[model samples]
Target chain A: MNSKTAIKFSVLLLLFVLSCALSLLFGGSETMHLSDITSQDFIFWQIRFPKTITAIIAGSALAAAGLILQIIFRNPLAGPYVLGISSGASLMVALSILAGNSFHVFSDFFIGKSFIVVSAISGSFLVTLLILLISKKVNSNVILLLIGLMFSQICGAIQTALEYFSDPNSLKSFVIWGMGSLANTTNKDLLLFVPLAVLCLASLLFFIKPINALLLGQNYAQNIGINFKQSRFYLILISSVLTGLTTAFCGPIAFVGIAVPILSRMIFKTSKQQIHLLSTVLLGSTILLFADALCNSLLLQVSLPINMITTFIGAPLVIYLMFKNKHW
Target chain B: MKGEAMISIKNARLGYKKSGAEISVLKNIGLDFYAGDVIGIVGLNGVGKSTLLKTLCGLLPPLDGEVRIEGELMTQIALSELAKKVAIVLTEKIGGFNLTTFDVVAAGQMPYTNSFNRLEKKHKEIIKAAIEVCGLKEHQFKLINELSDGLFQKTIIAKALAQQTPILLLDEPSAFLDYASKHDLFLLLKKLAIKENKCVLVSSHDLDLLLKYCSKLLVIEEKLAHLISVDEAKTDAAFLRIGGGFI
Candidate 1:
């Protein structure tokens, strides 16, 4: 790495840490004074600490996922949320819950939430497989993008229709899940989220060579002896896994999945995935932590949904990028 | 250097593989490429000039007969070995990448690199020579997407050069380039063929200019590839009948 990149990385790391600190110390209540160990210290350690880590993990996973999708699809605007892969997970989880209720399974079940999470992940994997199959048949990125949007619409409609007939308590919880939150993940869930994100990110890093060659498109990549189908398959699998875990724990926290990678590209002034991937992790976490901090601070204790915060920031950027460059 | 065939096609049929059936694009192609030969294939749009080259490069397998490289069937050679034998420059634009010209050129070494794709000193030297040969020293660090069509064409050619293969194929390499850049590109190809002892096959719609530099002409007429002397190609009965102007 050059000196400039190293310096930029260091600055981004510092900002990430600062954002995490803010999210931990000051959220939903008075900022805990580190010097004074009061009852509030428990809130800091137990609640805000896990929430901060949750924000960082979810944000970084989405960021890397976005970068991978963009590279494999050869579209700068691709991401887990935008491609409807997360909605697929959400659909599966919702379906599992409704099925359990109809069978009276939830009444006797204590550990069924884990079953929902497992089903959600498999739903994500199935959708990913379907998308890859279609992508292989169609060479156009725009066509695949339209197909993903259609998948989102179909999946979202099914979920909403299922919600219409569900019980009041189930409906309310499902609605809350759709809004997305970083505060909901318990320390127990952290054991699941952290390792999965690390493994997927390792897969992302390992794919640097194929992804770099893919910049010239699949024909060129294939001609150069990189097995194109295998490369794309592994990348899609890793991207979906990351998206699935985040959707399972934190819900579909939109925008960060699509926007942070672009923001990193803008900041670094380069489009190399190796640099963009690394920068996406640091900058994605920094932005999400800051957004969570804003949620805690801006509205004065009544925190906005993390999804709402990201969409508010991200939607306009997507519009601006589409306008500024017809390349997308 | 101009002795033996680098690649030879024997009655190969070119076509598109569709669901449950194949669409025949072109048929009955027989040709041999040798070092120090600049063979230019010319045809009208939609006449499958690109298809013939794609078939030759093994991007699409021949529907019939065999394509042999150094007496071994092309189907028998692994993709890695075939890549080392032939390299092609495509005209398609790969935009939205933040890659520099140097980085794009460096990707040419992928087939030879280690799993991690680290450029050894030898690889780096070859990549440097390719950039220099394409006269891209001033724009090596420029982002590829920011370059003009002519420069982008050069950058893609430079990438093909870095592959260090014995046979190079380019499909309409000068299509988007200006006249001056077009001449420069062909001049570079001619030099590569004669001096570097590489076999180069280029397909172009610019028949007059192509005929000027090409040692032999392959004319696509009525879905058939015709290898004729540059002198005879100008007035061949089929060439006159097809009557593609600007020849």
Candidate 2:
């Protein structure tokens, strides 16, 4: 690592710390001033703490997923949302809601209860499997990306059909979940998400050599002794799990999955997977916290949906990057 | 010491199958490459020169027969293990054009690094030495995208050198280079094979450069392959028929 990279990493770390501090202090009827220790403090500790922790976990997971996907596909635009993994999870959640199921029940009995969590996990994995199968058949990267987009549209059509058949109460619940929120998550949810995310991220870090070699191209990577199939499978598996977990917890948080990695590359001026992963993690958390803070500060009557804020901030960045240069 | 074969292929048959149709590119080909030998492969555009290079380096599996590295089957060896024995420099431009020259060369150390992806002291020393040998120390910190095509070619060659593999395969290393750059590249390859004791195999369209610099030539004609000593290649009727007139 060079001094510039070290300095940039340190700055991102500092910003992450500040974001965590700010998130802890503010949110959902819990204002903790330095002067008073009241029920509000307890509320902040209990309610806001879990939510903030969930956001951090989700942000890191999604960003890492995006980074991995981009490297694997060799396309800058590849991500959980664009590749239909989010839609897969969303369609599962929508199905569960229509069946009058609770999300927490799925989290609890994910291992055994042949119902909600199992269905969601299988749905996500199935989409990833289809993608892998298609990638093997169709060697063109652009065609793979288009296939993913078509899958996303197909999932959206199913979701709409389900909504059409559901009653008002179930529809309302599904709509709220679709809007994406990090709030109301319990410690058990954290137990389910954090470990999986960490494991996936660790595996991703382990495959950095192959991913870097891929920057040169597949033939070159293989020539350098990187097993092309093994590395590609590992990366896809890790990315699917990361994206699946985040979409399970927070409903399809739009654009953060696609945007954070791009932003990190721009700011850090490097596309090395290691640097991209680290910078994406820190920048992802900061973006989420900052957007959540904005949502709270602006909407006095109602808590604005988290996805709306993320989309608002993220879309502009995507547009700017798209138009900036062809080389990147 | 003078004629020990570093790479040996026995009855190698390489090709691809599609729709139950097998197209044979190389049939029953066999050759031995020794250290300090600069070998050149020349053929028309579609004649499997690149495929042969890839197969010899163990990037592609042979349809039949085996490639042996020091008497070990290439397929039986682990990828990282195989990587330590042979390195290839391709003609494709690297995707991360924003990387510095040093970073691009350091990427060669990937097979050598441990879990944290940190290079060992020995790995770093090798990378530095490769940079110096490639004459790229002045451009070490320069962004790869900003460099001339000649520098980019050298940077890739430097990466292959840093790999420290005994056998090096280059696919059209001089394809996009200017006259001066091509001259410099051939000079560098000759020195690398002669002084550094590397068995180098390069594919090129410049027959003149290949004839002057390489000790042996592998000519692919009409989908058949032949390996001939460069001196005999001059008077051989088969070589004369294929060599034609232009470089």
Candidate 3:
């Protein structure tokens, strides 16, 4: 690594550690003192620990997913939500909560517990599968992106229709989820998310060579012994799992997936997949923790949504990248 | 040609099918490509020159018939095994990458690396040789995206050379190059084919340059394919009729 990369990595590492500490220190009704351990510490431990870990997991997962999708598609705009994946999961969650219909409605036999997470994951996977099928048939990248946007719009329409008929109480709950929050998840949810995120990250590590090959373009990657279809399938599978998990625990936090990887690339000054992947994970966690802090500290009566903060930061970065670099 | 045929395609059919319409590009093409031969393929745009190269390199499956290497069908061979036998340079421009010119060339060794993407000592040696051969030693540490188009093209060629495969394929390698860069690339390709005993096939719009440099020629015309020795290609009645129009 060059000096520039080294400095960026160190700064990110420091931010990650500081954010973890800050997340543990401040939040909930009462803040805990650092010097003394008390019953309030247990409340802070129970409420804040899982919430903070969930944010970290969500951040790392989304950022890594976005990086992989962008590199594979060779489009900086490609992300977990860009291809209708988050919309699919969100729509499924909306249907389950707003319509009061159980997942068993889709299948004759189903277990009731963990149904929300399962349904969300399956919904995202189904949409990812559809995108993959379309990609195989269509050779144009712009057309694929347009199709993905259309899919997102269709899912949004369905979500809106469901919300229109929902009872007010269920609608309130669904709306809160839609705003995106890390506070609602429990330790059990963290147990579910942490391992899944780590496993997906591990699988992505195995794909470094293929991702590097992809930077040369698809035909060149294919010529270099990568089975394009198989590699793409694996990439989509991992990205979907990561996206699905984050959406399940924290709702669809927008733009973190898209923005973090691009930010990491600018900071590191390299497009190599390995460096981008690592930086994305760390940078994502740092941004999410900071956003969560701002959401907690600045809001008086109503806490600002995580999605709102991410969109605020992400939109300008997108504009800057587009205007400054024509080739990216 | 001192050894057995390295690549053989028999009774191949090339075409595109869209919305229930089938368009045949090339039909029943049979050919044997040998080591130490620099073959030039000349054809009009959309004449299936790229499709033929893709099929030979196993990028596309032949609609009909078979491609064989060392007496085995191409489809049955693993992708990694196929990569060891051939390498290709494409016409598309690459995006921004902070890779040194040497790192760009070292990517050719990906097929031989273990699953972790680590390069062995021998791989490093091959990469060094590739960089030296391309005359890019001074620019080895320069970022790939910063190089001019001519140097970038040379870097891609150096990457292919690093693969050290028995056969190499290039699609319009000199399409965007200056006259001097184009001349130097073709000369280097000819030298590599003869001195290293590798089979090289290239598609080109520069018919005059192809005629002067290539040992053999494959011409695609009217949905048919013809392979002829360069000497015979010069005197054939068909050649005189087409003349400079082939360019």
For model 1, how does the per-residue alpha-carbon lDDT over B1-247 read when each residue is reduced to its tens digit? 4466888999878888888598888888788878888998877788888888888778888888888887789888887777788888987887675678998888888888877777899999999999998889999988888899888988988988999988899999998888887888889899999998888999987777777898888878787888888899768876655554534
Residues A1-328 of candidate 1: C-alpha lDDT, one tens digit per residue: 6788889999999998899778877765567666644565767767887898989988999899888888877878888887788889999988988887777665543356566667677877788778877887998777887888898899999999999989899999899999998988877778777887888887777877888888889778877777777888788778877888888888888888788877777778664578888899988888889989888888785888888888988899988987876543
Docking class of 2: medium
C-alpha RMSD values across all candidates: 3.0, 3.0, 3.0
Two-chain complex of model 3, DockQ on C-alpha atoms against the true structure: 0.62
Give the per-residue lDDT of model 3 (tens digit) for A1-328.
6787788889899999998877666644445567534564666667888878988889999999888888777777777777888989888877665433543453422232256667677778889888877877887767887998899899989988887888787778778888899888887666677887899998888898898888877777877788877898789878888887788778888888888877776677665678888999998888888888777767545567888888888878877986875445
Q: Which regions of candidate 2 fall more than 4 Å away from where they truly are?
A: A34-42, A96-118, A132-146, B1-4, B17-22
Candidate number achieving the greatest TM-score relative to the actual structure: 3
Which lDDT values do the candidates have, in the order given? 0.83, 0.79, 0.81
For all candidates, state DockQ relative to the true structure: 0.45, 0.54, 0.62
Identify the superior model by TM-score, candidate 2 or candidate 3. Answer: 3
Stretches of candidate 3 exceeding 4 Å from the true structure? A1-4, A36-40, A98-113, A132-147, A300-302, B16-22, B97-103, B138-147, B245-247
- Give the TM-score, chain B only, in order for the candidates: 0.94, 0.90, 0.90
lDDT of 1 at A302: 83
Model 3 lDDT, full chain set? 0.81
Ranking by DockQ: 3, 2, 1
The fraction of reference A/B contacts recovered in model 3 reads: 0.63
